[model samples]
Target: MRANLKTANLKSGDLPGDVTHHPYDAYGLPLMVEPASPALAKDPLAVQSWFAEHHRTLEALLPTYGGVVLRGFAIPDTMAFNAMIQCYDTDPNGYAGGLTPRKNIAGKVFEASRVPADQKIILHQEMGYLPSFPKMVAFYCLKPSETGGCTTIGDMRRFQKQIPANLLDAVHERGVLYRRNYRAPGPVSDPLVALFRREWTDVLQVETVEQAEEACRAVGCEAVWEDDGSLSMRYRSSGFVNHSVTGEEVWFAQVQGMHFNQARLAQNYDTLNKAFPGGRPRPIEILFGDGGDIPEDMVTPLYDILDRLAVNLPYEHGDFMLLDNIYTAHGRQPFTGSRDVQVGLVF
Candidate 1:
């Protein structure tokens, strides 16, 4: 089968068998790959083999490109996508103790975050707050939205360079602390409980508070059981991480989503204010490692930098994107109509 692979602005190279590389854009935001022969679509084994041959190439290019989009291969369903990802990551990681509420669609394949379509999710690296996280994240688009829905990506390396020097120094020196409170599951009719996608039970995946605390401790989070059956979890980590491959320090925290005054949380805060007129503390908050509030002055410019550098990737059915989670952060845009994106994480 003829396989045409393109790296951004790089010339085609001779490879074993029928595979060929083609030059694309200079930025390499998403180097696209496609099969030259249509017959390859029907042979899953051949497709898998072809991708396996180029696995090292993809890994080497991922840090430089930030991401890669494979198109026109006719990845029929989640099962097919799962097989494809296995070529790169033999054992993809499962979503356990994950913050987002997602259903497992197949082995290691999960439905993307279950947030309201109208709400924009702030750009964040997957599981960035946790001590350990996936090295790569793959998204397979099953269906495309009618309008506005696009997976947004930002280069953390670029964000790191452009961010204010003082803020960078502060975060690097003091780190970031994330505070999350998971309330006990309430009746389905309760709007407040509905807003919190998962309860302490679901998040901890255990029946009793003791087990929950143990699970939290395993992940390096300090947990406390509240008087009202709520669970409070606190963890601290640096805002920047050295890219596993590039060794460049990248902005790696969830400050955009965790900070109270950021635009990303403005809608949630407005809803919360209307629900509780007296104003209640947010279910999640971010602070300095020493527990001081993050200054709005720091957050405002960070938000602006993310906005300026964000790349909105419009989805098409059967498209698959694999991202280097360390150097790239992903988010969702407000959308209308039906959209289905499945995700698989690689450790």
Candidate 2:
């Protein structure tokens, strides 16, 4: 432990300079750290220096709190955000076989997600479907939308504790299977198809089916090429994962989002269902590890659980947040106007 700094239960005026700490909510979700003085708030370099000195303390707190929010510092741009994370001396992680549409914008930084503004991104641990995933995920907000674009977070350990014992047992016994079908290269005529579909090349960051298969295999997924030029990949993973540092079992799966539950898809479900046969040709399908159908009854309860525990964090320009990927689940809320958030993954 660093001298004069404690890992847990940090409070205002505990650290040097004008920086102070406070709980974002009753849950202590993103232990909000900010400069109490106006001069320090405007000086990005000062904020950077402070973070560099106390990063280890923040790191220690992650397993307990799941995330930390650095507010009031005007971080300026993506490059600065990259610099802040680099203060911890972690290398930039690549997003290979990623599902969301995002473009790399700066060194080790990418636009958060390219989904339509009105769409609600369901809560899930980043890259939870993969065999290996980042230990930490950082998000920097360049701009907040005019309305309703909060980046939501949920504590997975809390969620795991709240999940009914029978449901937890079922998850542990059956595990989870995620199947993704990347569309063949072509223009999609249907708006619904356009919203849900991604080309294999876009997902794997490769031009050839062979390369895509190799990439999928590297990540413990079984890949197959369909005659129609579509690509399908399947992966089996435990519905719960143990936290890397704390060794606590936590809810760490994307089943709800990948399943595209009726509550989430709403009226679009019927249209999408009709557009794609058996919904097999859609972006992805989530099922039991044995390839059994995941009934709505099993998945809907999770939505309710997450909703009850969610912390809808409204972003301010220059706000940066770091999440312990294994301990936290994050999502996006629908919004209007311009919203720009960049993300970085670190192990």
Candidate 3:
């Protein structure tokens, strides 16, 4: 194992089995962890020990690095991956009221978003729009895509700096309001039903609309029943937040991800336009806290900044990545073939 002068004091014993760290020159110096010894890569127990020995140093590096990619570990299955995560954080968060459609694998581990491979998910902090969110998010690659399924990450600090100063000030002063419409599932012949396959019951995990409303209220959202028995909810949240450890201001909202103009929502628009002669309202919308429309001109520049700052991290089978949720924003690139990634959250 090579000695790291910065973390030399934190070293416990001669690092087990030749693990190596590589630093990247992105917005934050993101680290890449790899095994130098082939035998070490195949042994989950040895990797777990290595992580435990350097736990303190890893925690300290997170604020500066934003995240780390642990490759060549050959984590065998969900059980082994969960074991590795427990080394850093024992408390795993369950996926409740999560926007994406995912199935739990074991304990708190889940299949990553089941969105179509052709869709490109926009960059945003994980569940940043919610009243509560995990402090850290980790992804384990069980199977890598044959082509184009890189997980793109953006440094929140850099994104904050790159955006327009006036827009940033406006968001800070007014915050943001998120609106979502959930319709009931029905025959595909119905346009609205086809558009939003997810029903309110599925999202709230409740049998009744009253229970759904109560659940919304618990999460600080205002819920109203539409004339067609659909549920509409609005949540107000800050566009920026302070990093839990460093207290640095970070761009932490779902503006780009939920915005209609973004590529991620392009398919929704197409479906809606085809169903209705006139355009249908966006299922999700982001507005200024005062309910004022966020100018498209302002949003355009932020998208540009995100594009400029994003770093694409392609996955290899058995690769694992841990991200400081407040410091980094993540997304997915459009891919072909099968891509199986699992996620676990640390709260």
Q: Write the per-residue lDDT of candidate 2 for residues 233-330, one digit (tens) a residue.
A: 88889887766565567777686788756776787888877877674545777888998777777777878888888899889989989888888889
Q: What is the number of backbone collisions in each predicted candidate, taken in the order shown?
A: 0, 0, 0
Clashes of 3: 0
lDDT of 3 by residue, 216-314 (tens): 876667887777677777888888777666556787777777665534345566765454332333466788889887876777777778888888877
Highest-scoring model, lDDT: 2
TM of each candidate vs. truth: 0.87, 0.90, 0.87
Q: In order, what lDDT does every prediction score? A: 0.74, 0.78, 0.73
Task: Sort all candidates by lDDT, best to worst.
Answer: 2, 1, 3
Error of 2 at 70 (Å): 0.9
What TM-score does prediction 1 earn? 0.87
Kindly report which residue stretches of model 3 are placed more than 4 angstroms away from their true locations once superposed: 1-18, 26-29, 37-39, 87-93, 262-281
Please, what are the lDDT tens digits per residue for candidate 1 over residues 1-347? Answer: 01113432222343334433432345557666666656555666676677677665666667667777777776877788888876544222245467777878887788999889988887889988778787888899999899977888888878878878878889988999987878876666667656753587887678887888888877778887677677878889987777666556778878877777736556566776454333333467778898888887888777888888788878888888888898888999999999999998887
Can you give the lDDT of residue 1 in candidate 2? 18
TM-score of 3: 0.87
